[model samples]
Target: MNDTTTFKQSLTINLRVIGALLMREIITRYGRHNLGFLWLFLEPMMFTLGVTAIWSYTHANHLGSTLPIAAFTLTGYSTILLWRNMPTRCVSAVIPNLGLMYHRNVVLLDIFVSRIVLEVTAVTASFSTLGILFFSSGLMKAPEDIVPVLIGWMMLAWFGASMSLFVGALGARSEVIEKIWHPISYLTFPLSGAAFMLEWLPAPARAVLIWMPTVNCCEIIRQGFFGPMVHAHYDMSYVAIFNTCLMLLGLAQVRLVAERIAPQ
Candidate 1:
């Protein structure tokens, strides 16, 4: 076979492998129980909605006139739910599924990709459903520009997927990494731009925070959602370049993990 044909066959095989792994992951994680896979969307939806409700109630007296607390909470928390849960879910993905690696078609990268895909899909659905329901119920306005919102969402997903791969690979190589990441993630939460807007922060703080890829993506999403009502600062070029470089690094780490995995 020619080089092109060989590459096509390999790509096709890998895609099939990934598809199978996705199904397996869904089944394994959600199970055939109450709500089944619907929980994928429902779980995150419930979490985001709960947080929004608490924020709306407690902060309403303080934040009522300044911003739309409901919309702000929805957008910010949804971004957090989407991006933050990925690495958590994927950090030890390979360790639990090491036995599956005995199958020739199942590889470490497939396991990592499947988990990331599942997470991104679940959070995206939850975010969209919440947006639509809130808008229709008059609780929040519809997004002013959906194009940038979607681009921002995808960028966050890219960042999440890259981080997941890197963390998952590292976890496979060392037990210490798994323990370390949990606290590290919790510490990073406040800095993730989930609780405040760029405009709310001081100029120097904003300048420093915008360099975080998650913060940049969140700013873009809020800009698209709030439009003139809110001022959001972001540099898409920075987010894109950072995500690309991180993903490349993640792929390299995944390759290293694959080399170390000796299927029993």
Candidate 2:
């Protein structure tokens, strides 16, 4: 077979499998619970609500120049959680769901795609409800631009997925990764885009933070929702480049891990 033709066929087959896995995950995950799909939407809402309440109480007086509390907190908090959850969930996916991979068809991509699908579903339900409720009530006016925001979201998602896959693959073999995860998570908060916005951070700290690709994800996404008021500085290209590298690394790691890890 021609190499090009073979590659195309492989791609096609992969797409078919991905689509099937997404459907399967959605049905099985939500179907098992009585609340079912409601949980998907509710997870984000409750998460957002809890964060918003805590922040509003502490940062009530500090609006960060001209940014509104609701708009700033929503985008920043949601995007932060989005990136953070990817790796955490992905790491857990392998061990817990190993039984499903007994079939040859369930590859690493299946796990990655499944996690991404569920994450997207949760975010969609949450952010969609949030936007509608907030906008309808006149909480946020309108976005100045949406293109950069979208680019940021896609990059962040890719970053999260890639990083998670890499770590998950490592965890599959060593089994040591899961042990440090609690400390890793705790140490992650300061650097995470959730705790502070680009505008609010001190000049030096903000400059340092801009180097972190995850920060760009939240910053650009927040800018998309809040515009100039939130005061965000992001480099989408930076995130895109890092995400590409991470994804490749993760893909390679997954294959390696699979060779050593027999499906349970």
Candidate 3:
């Protein structure tokens, strides 16, 4: 076969491999019982709803903000799930699926991609469902601008997927990564801009926190949701540049791990 034909064939096979992996992952994780795969989105939805309820009960929006409490919590917690769950699911991902590596078509990248795709799809579904429910019930308002919300969400997915790939690859080399990551994830949750808007913080703290890509992503999403009612601080170019670098590093690390673990 010519080089072009060979490349096309490989690409087609890899796509099939990824699809199969996705199905297996869903069945294995969700099973075919009560709600089954529906739980994928429902799980995140319930968590977001619970958080919104707690915030409402405690009057978490007492910061002189005009945004609805339901909308604020939904947007904030949904973004948190997008970035947090992906990496958590991906860490030490390869070891559990190592048996599948015996199949020529199943690659390490496929495993990570399948998990990341699953998490992103689940979180996005949860966000959309809750948004619709809240709007209908008059608990939240329709977003002022959906374009930025979509852009911000896509950026967050990229950030999460890249970070998961890097973390998962490194995890194959050492178990310590998984241990260290748990605490770090918890510690960073408050600063991730999921619980508050950038405008709520003083100038000095806001300046430092804006450096986190997830924080910028939350700001972009909130800007879309609340519009001029809130001041959103973010630099899209900076986010794009950081995501690019991280993605490159992740791909390189995955390649290294694949070589190391390749069957003799």
Candidate 4:
């Protein structure tokens, strides 16, 4: 067969493999019972809702900002779930699915990709659903500019996927990753720009915190969301560069883990 034909066949096989894995992941995670996959987004939505309620009830001044509490909480918590859940699901993931490694086409990358896609889809859905419900019920206003929101969300997804791959691969090598990641995730949440706007930070803190990709992502998303009502700080170029490098590292690590698991 010619190179073109061979490439096409390989591409087709890989796509089929990914599709199968995605379906399997959904079924395995959500099951076929009540709400099944619906729970995927609903779980996060409910969590966000509870937090929003608490914030609203307590009159918690989020960094002394005047943004709508519900909208602010939704955007922030959803963003957290987007970046946080992927890595949480990925760490120590390979061992549980080692049985699938027996399949010729099933590779470590496929597993990671499946989990990442599942998480990104669930969180995005939750974010959108809550945003619409809030807007309709007069709890929050619609985003002023969607362009930055899309760009920012895509960037955050990229970051989450890459980090999950890297963490998942490393977890295969050592148990330490799984242990340390839990606390690290919790500690980082507050600083992730989800709880407060970057503009709320002191000038010194803002200067330093902007380097975090998640923070930049939050800034971009909120800029799209609250517009003039809030001042969002971000650097897309930095976010792009950081995510790209992390992706490269993640892919490289996954390759190494794959080779070790099933040598080519």
Best by lDDT: 3
* lDDT digits (tens) for residues 1-264 of candidate 3: 899999999999999999999999999999999899999999999999999999889887646886899999988999999999988998878888989999988899999999999999999999999999999999988999999999999999999999998998998889999999889888999999998888888999999999999999999998999898888999989999999999999999999999889543
TM-score of 1: 0.95
Candidate 2, residue 192: CA error in Å? Answer: 2.0
User: How close to the true structure is residue 253 of candidate 2, measured as C-alpha lDDT?
Assistant: 91
Ranking 2 against 4 by TM-score, winner: 4
Backbone clashes for every candidate come to: 0, 0, 0, 0
Error of 4 at 115 (Å): 0.5
As a TM-score, model 3 comes out at 0.96
Q: Each prediction's TM-score against the native?
A: 0.95, 0.86, 0.96, 0.96
Worst 10-residue lDDT window for candidate 2 reads 60-69
Cα lDDT tens digits for candidate 2, 1-264:
899999998888878777887677667667865887677778778888787777667776453355666776677667766777767777767777777778766786687777776786677567767867777888776667878767777787788788888887877766688677657965877787865677787899988999889788888777777665666888888878888998899999989977776677
lDDT for every model?
0.87, 0.75, 0.92, 0.90
TM-score of 2: 0.86
The 10-residue segment of model 4 with minimum total lDDT is: 255-264
Q: Mind giving the per-residue lDDT tens digits that candidate 4 earns over 166-187?
A: 9999998888999999999999
